[model samples]
Target: MEKGKVVVLEDRVPKLKERRRQKANRRLIAYLSFFFLFILCVLYFQSPLGAVGHVEVSGNRHLTAERIISLSGITKRTSFWKVNEQNVEEKLTRHPEIKEATVEKQLPNTIAIHVREWRRIAYVYDRQTFFPLLENGRLLKQEGTKTAPSDAPVLVGWKDGDAIAEMTGQLAELPAAVLGAMSEIHYKPTREYEDRVIVYMNDGYEVSATIRQFADKLSHYPAIVAALDRNVKGVIHLEVGSYFVPYSPPKKEDGDETTSP
Candidate 1:
């Protein structure tokens, strides 16, 4: 080998070692800085600066704020850095009535949790027991469960849990006047469609509709009723478009024609 080549080769080893040493030093400094920051965090969290002094909850209706906070295990004494948001969220979500929960930190000592609760739209009857079904498609306790809203529709013969989706959808599309006039809903599980709903109106009339077409048809009930003579009696047929036929009295009559409502 030439002398210059030999000298260059000899010089490269120390330079490589020095570079590795510098890299190692940088890594050590990073670790030390992280450790120091971690220590400071621990101290700060423990020193009342991170203690939860204020807790706020919003968007909760069915669930009480205190009950939700208790379930979350985040209290006034909870350390801000030590707060387990995921755990709190999971705990809040354990109740099927809760649709969603979001936890947010307000400041050094404040935590806010927003929760959306599932609203019960209808009640399902399994035999004689009536179980209230939430909008998210969960059945509440049947035996001695809390009373649902007085205006909520009572569902008869509907056990398929998926019916909740249709019920919610129909309710969403219905105008408030027609919706408030509804007294009962009978979910007839027909071979054609399980979502068929037979409604009993407060006006002593029955409505035939599938959940698919209920909202649209019900919304137009006012116009349909307006066209009909109120003196005539019959259930308003809405399964298709608006049609009103006179109610036939329970007797065998040959030529008797009833007036249309």
Candidate 2:
């Protein structure tokens, strides 16, 4: 009706048809993709392919694989996709011996659980029965059949609970070599220091140290022993300062220890 204006259905027909065809093709492609995805999900979930078939436990010493796996609550019936990693790990760390735990899912329907148990820093005696003192300062009663007798320090005359706890804490900080060298630790509270302790070394030597800064001072034990004359073994006093006091040859008092000179 207006000047220089024209409406022709034939001219626009091909363009409109082409656009509609392209849109239909996109819709068909989307439907096919969704259909194939649904099929895959159904096959995976409906059959035993997606279920956990095996469990692997590692990094455990005091605890067995079966025990750790049981604690993690992971069984063959547990769904691979439904297994919550965080939940299983938290469950494993609930035990007193377990210090850390991690959960990982492996390929081909397998779940892996990794754990780290606390170290046995020392031992204390209760009515002649030996108990392991953990790095966390907890006492655990177990058979001494597994112990080599020289594995850790034996705490004697440790009547005070707090003293034993502090001693365990100190022993845990020592290096493996230093801790292994110690055989016995007797609680001998002196007038000046209540935390005074007498340590008997495996190398036929004695050490006088207080509970405070015990680990720091004891770290130089290997060097101190190395510098001292091995032929002349006496007492390595670490309470006030690092010095070697040779045992006096004159034995006159009844208070002398059988082991000390």
* lDDT (tens digit, per residue) of candidate 1 on 77-161: 7887678778888889997788889988777678889998876666666655667667655678733234444546677666655
Clashing pairs in 1: none
Q: Write the per-residue lDDT of candidate 2 for residues 198-251, one digit (tens) a residue.
A: 999999999999999999999999999999878777999999889998775544
Error of 2 at 199 (Å): 1.6
By summed lDDT, the worst window of 10 consecutive residues in model 2 runs over 141-150
lDDT accuracy of residue 10 in candidate 1 = 79
User: In model 1, which regions exceed 4 Å deviation?
Assistant: 1-44, 47-50, 126-130, 142-148, 159-181, 188-196, 202-205, 222-234, 245-261
lDDT of each: 0.76, 0.87
Q: What TM-score does model 1 achieve against the real structure?
A: 0.59
